[model samples]
Target: MDEFNGTEINFHCMYIPFCDARDCDRELYDSPVDCPDCNRGMVALHFTILILMAIFITMGNLGIILVIKRNKIFHNSFNMFKCSLAFADLLVGVLVVPSGAYETASIMMRSFDPTALNRTDYLIGKDVAMIRPDSMCDRIYQEDIGGPGMFLSMISVLSVMASIFHLVLLSIDRFLAVWCPIKYNQRKALKDKCAISMIIFVWLVSITLSVVIPMSLGQRHFIHGLSPAMIFTLKTSNPSTGIFYATFGLGLPYLALLGLNTATGSIILIKHRNLVRRSSLSPSLNSGGRRKDEVKATITILVMIVVFTLSTLPAMVAVTFYNGTEHKKKGDATIRSIIYSTLILLLVSNSAWNFIIYSWRNDNFRKALKNLFTRKQQRQRAIIRWKQLKCSVLLLSEEKRRRKKLIKLTEASNSYSSEKM
Candidate 1:
């Protein structure tokens, strides 16, 4: 990473000590990058991680939605925003995860016969081109499918961007509730409508910024590897656009999230401390307890926003900094596979694991999820038992009919024999 922009060329390729039986150990006598075992193993590991993350995200967010829907405790503006985040994450699971697995497998299986670092591209003593272009690199990951691919890519961008924007909205919600309590309560009747409106507004803004703007005015990017759909900028040889997108698109938003969170937190803590100091009784009294609970909830939500945003930062940085050089395109297949896959996994992880956080932080959510699942399991069991009992009754009735038929047949046979005699 230190020499990421350096002019020095590294010919090294990562390799295992030996190919395992899982990949049949039939690696060609080529470079490590050309080893089928590496490709297979990489695909298996990456695909598993992506699929697992996808499942967790789908089920977890769905659980959050169900818990919120059924449990009246979470039926507020605050939890509505949480639901918005959950919905955005659901898109990531439904759209981005499968794409990531496909992209990873494609990238892993792809290898160039001859390294692209040759002098034909004229990258001699001069620095290798830092920005990788879609034109130069093979479109192994979701670019070749034409209309559907582009549509999926747009949705992918929308998903991640919507998640981030929802977090920002959460911060703003916290800021308003903490810093302006009187107004916040006065607007209580409108909060639900406002929250819904804000949710729609946030998604609109995300689509505009991530999809519309990019489509209208392209920004060159390095590598996005088709996961989390966190980024959708196209690439060119121009380096400045990538830098600009990274700075304004991701960096500024990240800093703003921090600023809003920090300011809101500081105000809440300071006010709480002052109240505690001035109060005649301990902060555990009814009034103080309510205040503490509100503060705790605010802080918890803020922590969630911070963590969700922070989880995506490293991946954004990693993808933004990846070079689009021919050498990077071909020579660093294995390296890129690991780095891009891990970064993509990081991107989707927050969306996937938010339910755990919800369960851990809020008792209501935990109890709700538990009750929902438990009740569902009980219902499923009851249905199965009912089905079994019905089948058993059916079998008993069938046996009785057979016995009656056998007796009738014997009586008829005896009558015929007596008549004949």
Candidate 2:
């Protein structure tokens, strides 16, 4: 079946470029698409990896959500953004990833039969349906409208967008807090209520873009050379949807994150430098204390930004370039499946690493997580968590005191004027 002309083409042959003929002795490749990577042992290994990664991602983020909920220290407005991001990341781990991983693994498992490495019914679009005769991909393609499948499709894009938006929100919050602390505090826009409002806005926008109408009707165009397992996410036939998602959904927000985080980091560094200058001149000043906390937080954010970019951008770029049933037809299953699935593993790796990042960089998060594992030493852990978090609380309380003092002075002046009258 490995045929280009009426005659059968040998799998080991190289194409003679000028002669326009494929031979085993020639330099150019004709046999490379046979997928040396899709051997049973390799597919099984990667399959195991996907499953394990999914489990870790699900459990890790779930722990983060629980720790944030149980601990009072994490209830601060900025930490609430972290909570929202964790929840969105959790949804990706739970709803979007596991099933897709299973589908991908199934595809890989049967990709190259030991009996027939050369004979092929698949690797071409016309016989693509034979890749899975009993697959629900058929049902999905037929508009069978299974609720779970449809929901999964929606959530694949949905959770990622929400996660990205939440990260953007965190960056914006950090930028505001660092670049103009006075203005940031005066507006009270990122107070608990405002944080809740913004979180709700993120989910709403993600739903509208990824699920509500665009994916509501399930207008899917299957991509050739890529498996249905991989195609399930971002399933749309609309050029407009793809274009808009590429431009706005994936593009602008990531750009915004880069700009905001860069600016925020630069500001924090400047402030730290100034504090160091002042501390050197006046040894009595405690100007260096909060700078450590700010720097740590900034570093955590930068780490997350880097992880998000590295994990996600490759998948987006690959899927964008090699999209649709018409695209990548010349390529064999080996290149398509291996590279795409590997990129997906990288993408989901983002969900798994947040707990590690927080634990490494953040003491409050570590303390809260430790509290979940043991019941003893409650008071010590509480003190530790409170110490880590109370600086921001003290600053907020100090501002409230100033506002109250201003209001009292105004009231006294008005009362004195009334008495004089």
Candidate 3:
């Protein structure tokens, strides 16, 4: 049996090793892993999914932004929150998804051409025959900001965290709107400043937590030159840091979102039920349309909350587990990696699909978007008609001026002839 070491298990392309039996030795080929064919298929599938997600996310978020910007009807506090969320999702699509696709493509390419992997010193030692495979593969860990890949990772992390914060803000906004309409109205009047402040705060906290704090911690860890055991014990194995980080970063916000959404949803349901009962008792009530609109809005919010929870839960569980665990076996690590990757894709999909949810659930939003596009077309046509009308008027004025000049010339000629005679 091949005894898998940490380095071998931690290699990039864990599903498909770069060095085959022909390139390296029997040991590389003897590893228990997914078949190369299946791995290639999986890579292709992942790349395709990510590319599609990026496209949808870009288009969807941009559409939401355009719709909100163009339509004055959507300029409320809740829509402002939606706009912020869309912007954050847009960043994920633009920055994160493409980067992930590129990395997946790189892996695919390396899988096909193993030599490309060997070209790097970190993958291949000075001597081919005496290549230290373990050290070579181990040196190239992920998420180190020494390159563009890591920089994208950092941005993605920032955007994702910002997005989650925006979601929490959105939930709170909905809660207040449903639970306290008068107070919500007052707050809504001051929404512009408040929304901007909240957005700025979200980004600041996201950057501090994801980038500044991590970098500082890493620097301290490196500067101290602690042993692996000490590092694990102090940082990874420390339950306090893990608990605090997980709770604040992922757990608490999600819990708050869930609670707020639930409360808001219940309030909406009760109000809707009461409205329905009243309308049934008095068929003359004109609130049927308004009730329908309210129901649509409530459904949209509930769908967003549900999607967010579903998409985020897996990654949250994986992170919390990894952070809390002292030691993980090779199989466990591999499984966690796969689970984490899948969950990340789910998270990206969550961001991408919110626009669809809005479109599907909210008739007003859909109509507003349709009207926006329709109005754009009408505006273009109006401009063209205006230009055409202006041209015709100018032509008619010129014709009149020319006729006057001709009459003057003819009259002058006649007068000159008569005088000569």
Q: What is the lDDT of candidate 2?
A: 0.61
TM-score of 2: 0.67
What does candidate 3's lDDT look like per residue over 1-421, in tens digits? 2232222211122222221222233234332122332344554565666688889999999989988987788888788889988987898778767765554344324332334334433332112222233222222233222355445555655666787788888777767666776666667534678878987888888888666765666532211111111000012224565676677877887788878878877887898678678865764355555445555666677678778779866654643343212213545544554555666567567777789898888777888778666878579768999999999999999999999999999999999999999
Per-candidate clashes, comma-separated: 1, 0, 0
For each candidate, the alpha-carbon lDDT, in order, equals: 0.60, 0.61, 0.59
> Candidate 1 on 42-104: residue-level lDDT in tens?
445545666777888899999999889877777878789889889988987887667645653
Indicate which candidate wins on lDDT. 2
Model 3 residue pairs with clashes:
none
Off by over 4 Å in 1: 1-39, 103-145, 182-190, 218-248, 279-284, 324-333, 376-421
- Model 2: residues with Cα > 4 Å off, grouped in runs: 1-43, 101-146, 180-189, 220-231, 276-286, 323-332, 375-421
lDDT of 2 by residue, 220-239 (tens): 43121122323245534457
Q: Per-prediction TM-score, please?
A: 0.67, 0.67, 0.66
The residue pairs in collision within model 1 are: 132-324
